[model samples]
Target: MGALTIKNVCKSYGPTDVLKGVNIDIQAGEFLILVGPSGCGKSTLLNMIAGLDGITSGEIQIDGRVVNNLPPKDRDIAMVFQSYALYPNMDIRRNISFGLEIRKVPKSEQDRIVNEVSSMLQIDQLLDRKPSQLSGGQRQRVAMGRALARKPALYLFDEPLSNLDAKLRVDMRTEIKMLHQRLKTTIVYVTHDQIEAMTLADKIAVMKGGIVQQFGSPRQLYDEPANMFVAGFMGSPSMNFIPCKVVSMGNETGVEIDGGAGTFKLPVRSNQLKSSEGQEVMLGIRPEKVTHKIESHLENSDFHLAKCRVSINEPTGPDTNIFIHMNGAKVVCRSTPDSAKDPGEEMEMMFDLSKMVFFDPKTEERLA
Candidate 1:
């Protein structure tokens, strides 16, 4: 049996519908991520599962038992929010064991559990101090410690690292991943951060406008997106979509791209060109797939090579980000820092067409 099952769950407030027939089945010990932009209902769905908000329709089952009508306190779940939410007056030890105290757990047992959790989170020294005496990262760990103390069947995390600084956020992300590995407890995390979702989730559900856009592993979503929204949303620099036309070159059918230097035809074996020939289509390429000619590790036959002027160059430590124009659309290339030329200089580039994606211009659905 699945750990948690949400069957056709829907939520609405007054005239506004926040969730539209959302459905998901999470396996026991799976790290599930709900990721999307604001007002996309990721948090609202998490809240419904936590029983902090009511479900307008459908049922939620935990361990094969209906939990839709249960109160938050009755659910065997722990939640950690963006804000640490540690008690102001209570020391870390008290805050960590507060939930146990309310449930009438024995005093000696609570102390043992708090010590184990605090030690695991590496915050044992801070256990004697109040929240005001701890750093932001330490406090965040304490918040996690509080949740970890319960050893609950389910954990719901709502943007837990959003409040921390960038550097701290990175550190905490690793810590959370390690903690999950050690505990092997089921977790449903909500975040808009693509890196977090990609790194931590066993299964990712991308939401948009109160609907699920796609649900799959990170590689599946990147390689075969359901639509343009998902293709553009999952990557760092985002996928570049270039408008092109399918034209016939002698007896062969191919896609034409205006590379500024000249019009080049790229063969399309995956997308049947019978009906699409002489029609407009979209070409989607990721930044990493674009590269400088000299720095390209692939052989000449591996990718489609072209020459274009560098419109911009952004060096980000490990790799240089180069921008160029193709068919009136801006394209980004990830190249070695040493091989990047100055802006306005003409440079040879290779577009790795093997990994390239084709889409229907009208529907924005993948054609290849």
Candidate 2:
């Protein structure tokens, strides 16, 4: 089994702590992603797992064996680095075969493994070129090929595609996903790009300040973020936050939003409303959830329609972003390109509050 377990892991540089009590259990063949902003200790934790850094406390287990004290080579893992750390003087063939040579694999076996890995990465034609002579993407393929040739139990990737251009990054991301599916090897990938984490990982661990903020599938993180930090971090264009006071209307409780021209009450059914009356809360709604009203969506009890003046319109190919003012804050709504209105025009918009989330303004914690 290629399973991994991190128990109460901690790392420190004298008085400064980098990681604190991190715990994650990864099943065999799972694609796990470590994602967070820089200085959040993601790379530190990954280094500890790879035996490249010392652990101040706790244990790291691989396939049921504790590997905290084991050397990197003995940990039965291969790493692909962000820099595509290939030898500039050596050709791709030599670069890939060098590891097997150090391990004393027979010459014939080394040749066969090199051929297999090169073909697998579709770099067979470039095997004769040196790292300096190849494009960025080609060098990246060679880096992956070297790691694959090892056939190790765990593969660790440290921002492997960070050096590629935007288009190349997208291509490599797809390639990496395909490679993972074909090999079915356990992998631990580190990246700060939320898109990469969502697209490539079977499980994602969002970390901040040495603490794991949330851990789950991409869908869970996107739909039900644990707190404001996670909700804001995971989505593109981001979930909007509108500060408002909880108010009561007859038997229902909700918040009031003023869209420049008028005020509207959006009733919300949440247990937290029992004590949240008159308290400041942040109403969280994703851009896509707020859009041009449709007759079918208006049938839902939780759907709310309001007239708002569009302050700006940005066309993003797939959809147009309409910016409006609500509760004195700028709110973004996603509308079909043809349905979006020009700036300064009044438009009717719908809010799907069934999936809306609430958070405490002071604590930033989610409210049920």
Q: Pick the candidate with the highest TM-score.
A: 2
| Candidate 1 deviation (Cα RMSD) | 2.0
TM-score of each: 0.94, 0.97
lDDT of 2 by residue, 189-288 (tens): 9999999999999999999999999989999999899999999999889999999889998888889888776888888867677667898889999999
**Global lDDT scores for all candidate models:** 0.88, 0.92
Quote the lDDT for 155 in model 1: 95
* Local error of candidate 1 at residue 228 (angstroms): 1.3
Best by lDDT: 2
CA RMSD, predictions in order: 2.0, 1.4
lDDT of 2 at 183: 89
Candidate 1 lDDT: 0.88
Residue-level lDDT of model 1, residues 59-83, one tens digit each, is 9988788999999888899999889
